[model samples]
Target: MNHKAWSIHFIYAGVILLLAGGQMYAVESYQLTPSATKFLAHNVGPGPETAQGAINHFMVNSNTGVRETITPPGWVAWAALSAGAVLSVHGGMLIANKR
Candidate 1:
């Protein structure tokens, strides 16, 4: 194939991603509130600042009742939306550049 063909593919994939990702993110966002609460409840101590540690903390706290008054990452939905938007724009740019 050629650059133009590849660019067209990118643009199409990006549009699909934007639409699907938006819907998925919206649905998932609603279900995340409880998970977020649990995340806050688990991440209270001086646990390792790593993804693995966070998972471990959540698992450990799930077995026990360790509640905390901290804020979890609330920008998850917005961040996902922004990523979809970025992909859309990047694909648009690729199409434009190829044309």
Candidate 2:
């Protein structure tokens, strides 16, 4: 309800964003296990991305594993990094002002 409380929430959100951004940036790609991929395909039918002119994300099934082509935009990482930095800095400033 108070400024400090909001600041703490900001800090928490910023930290989570930072962690998520770091993870997204660090891992270029990942694959689901064969069994997991099979399960997913079985439950969720249709792969539009497999066809031409598909605007949505989709996964590829292969012997190795299933890989989803989400977060294809390169700017996502930079956006997350910038947002996290700004949020974290703003939160720290608010906390400092309280003292």
TM-score for each candidate, following the candidate numbering: 0.40, 0.62
Write one digit per residue (lDDT tens) for candidate 1, span 1-99.
Answer: 876677667667667766765665556333334456566545554465777667667665565544333332546546656776776677678778775
Judge candidate 1 at residue 26 and give its lDDT.
55
Per-residue lDDT for 2-68 in model 2, tens only?
A: 9999999888888888887888788776565666656656556555555431322233343545544
For model 1, the run of ten residues with the poorest summed lDDT: 65-74
Clashing pairs in 2: none
Best-matching candidate per TM-score: 2
- Per-candidate Cα lDDT values, in order, are 0.61, 0.69
* Clashing residue pairs found in predicted model 1: none
> In lDDT terms, how accurate is model 2?
0.69
Stretches of model 1 off by over 4 angstroms after superposition:
28-80
Query: Cα deviation in Å at residue 58, candidate 2?
Result: 14
